[model samples]
Each structure stands twice: as structure tokens, then as C-alpha cells.
Target: MPMAADEIVSLIVAGIPDAQVEMTDLAGDNNHWAARVVSESFRGLPRLKQQRAVYAALGDKMGGVLHALQLTTAVPVQE
Candidate 1:
């Protein structure tokens, strides 16, 4: 079974406490998703490292329950 959008967002936020996560179901099947996350944790981190953190939060679900994730991570923009 594919993971729920809220579940995925919760996991990401749990991992990155300061993260702001927004999720969109691109395919409406809960399999394809796009996530835009802004986090202070992303500061000074490479893009790959930021993505790894998100993936780590999902555990084994990456290839199992979660099929495709389009992820974007960035340091929070200044107001």
C-alpha cells in the first residue's frame, strides 16, 4: 500500500524539526508526490544531503510503500 500524503509530511517534519513541508499528490494515486520543504537544517547542506535526510525519515518506505517522490529542499526564504 502506498503511504498517505499526511503520513509522508509528518515523517519529514519529525526528522527535520524546523522544516516547513508542503505536499502535493501529482498522480492522485498516493504513489506520485511532490514535496517542497524549507528547513533551517538545509542551511549549509548540499542538495543531496538535504534529500538524504528526507529519505532517511521515510525509512524502508522509500521503495516499498512510497513509490515516487519529487522532493525540493531549501533554506527558508527570508521575509
Candidate 2:
């Protein structure tokens, strides 16, 4: 089964309380998704770690229910 876009956003936001998440369905099937997450918590972390946080948010769903995920993570600008 595929994951819903809102589910993805909710999980990521749950993981990163102050996160901004945007998701796109690459295949239009809701199975393949691309997520861009921006958070203050990611500020000093490595890119890989930032992405990992989003994945962690999804828990076991990452490779099972939601198989194809293209993730991009960034820290919010300090302005």
C-alpha cells in the first residue's frame, strides 16, 4: 500500500516540530514521492542526517509501504 501525502507531511512535522514540509507525487500514484523538508533543527547537521530525520519520522513505512522517496532537507535561513 502507498502512503498518503498528508500522512507524510504529518509524520515529518511530528518528527521535526518546527518543520516545513512539501511533498510531490512523482508518479502521480502516491507511491513515488519527493519531499522537501526545512527545519531549524537541521541547521548544523550534515545533509545526510537531515534526510535521515525525515525518514525516521516515517518509521518502518519508508522502505515498506512507501518505497520510493526522493528527499531533500535544509535548514531554515536565519534572515
Candidate 3:
């Protein structure tokens, strides 16, 4: 079964707490996703680590139920 956008966002929020997540169904199949994640926690992390955090949020679902995810991560601009 494919995961829903809400589920994805919920997982991320649960993991990061302060994360703001935007999810897109890239293929309309609910399997392929593009996620833009922004959080203060990601501020000093390397891009690889930031992405890994998001993937970890999804837990063991990635490459299985979640399929492919095109992820973009960033720290919220201080303003």
C-alpha cells in the first residue's frame, strides 16, 4: 500500500517536531513523492544528514510502501 501525503507529513512532524513539510504526489500514483522539508533543526547539518533525517522520519517505509521520494531539505531563514 502506498502512503498518503498526510501520513508522510505526520511522520516528519513527529520526528522533527519543528519541521514544516510540503508534499507533492509527483506521479499521481501516491508512490512517487516530492517533499520539501524546512526546519530549524536542519540549520547546521550537512545536506546528506538533513535528507537522512527526513528518511529516518519515514522509518522502514522507504523503498517499500513509500517507494521513491525526491526530497529537498532546508533550514528556515531567520527573519
Write down the lDDT of every candidate, Cα atoms only. 0.89, 0.90, 0.93
Please report the TM-score between candidate 3 and the true structure.
0.94
Model 3 score (lDDT): 0.93
lDDT of 2 by residue, 23-53 (tens): 9999899899999999999988999999888
lDDT of 3 by residue, 16-55 (tens): 9999999999999988899999999998999999999999
Name the lDDT value of residue 30 in candidate 3: 89
- Which one is best on TM-score? 3
Highest lDDT among the candidates is held by which one? 3
lDDT digits (tens) for residues 1-79 of candidate 1: 7889899988888888888999999988888999999998888999999999999988888888887999998998779
Q: What TM-score would you give candidate 1 relative to the actual structure?
A: 0.92
How well does candidate 2 score on lDDT at residue 39?
94
My TM-score estimates for the predictions, one after another, are 0.92, 0.94, 0.94
| lDDT, candidate 2, at 9 | 92
For model 1, the superposed segments whose C-alpha errors exceed 4 Å read: none
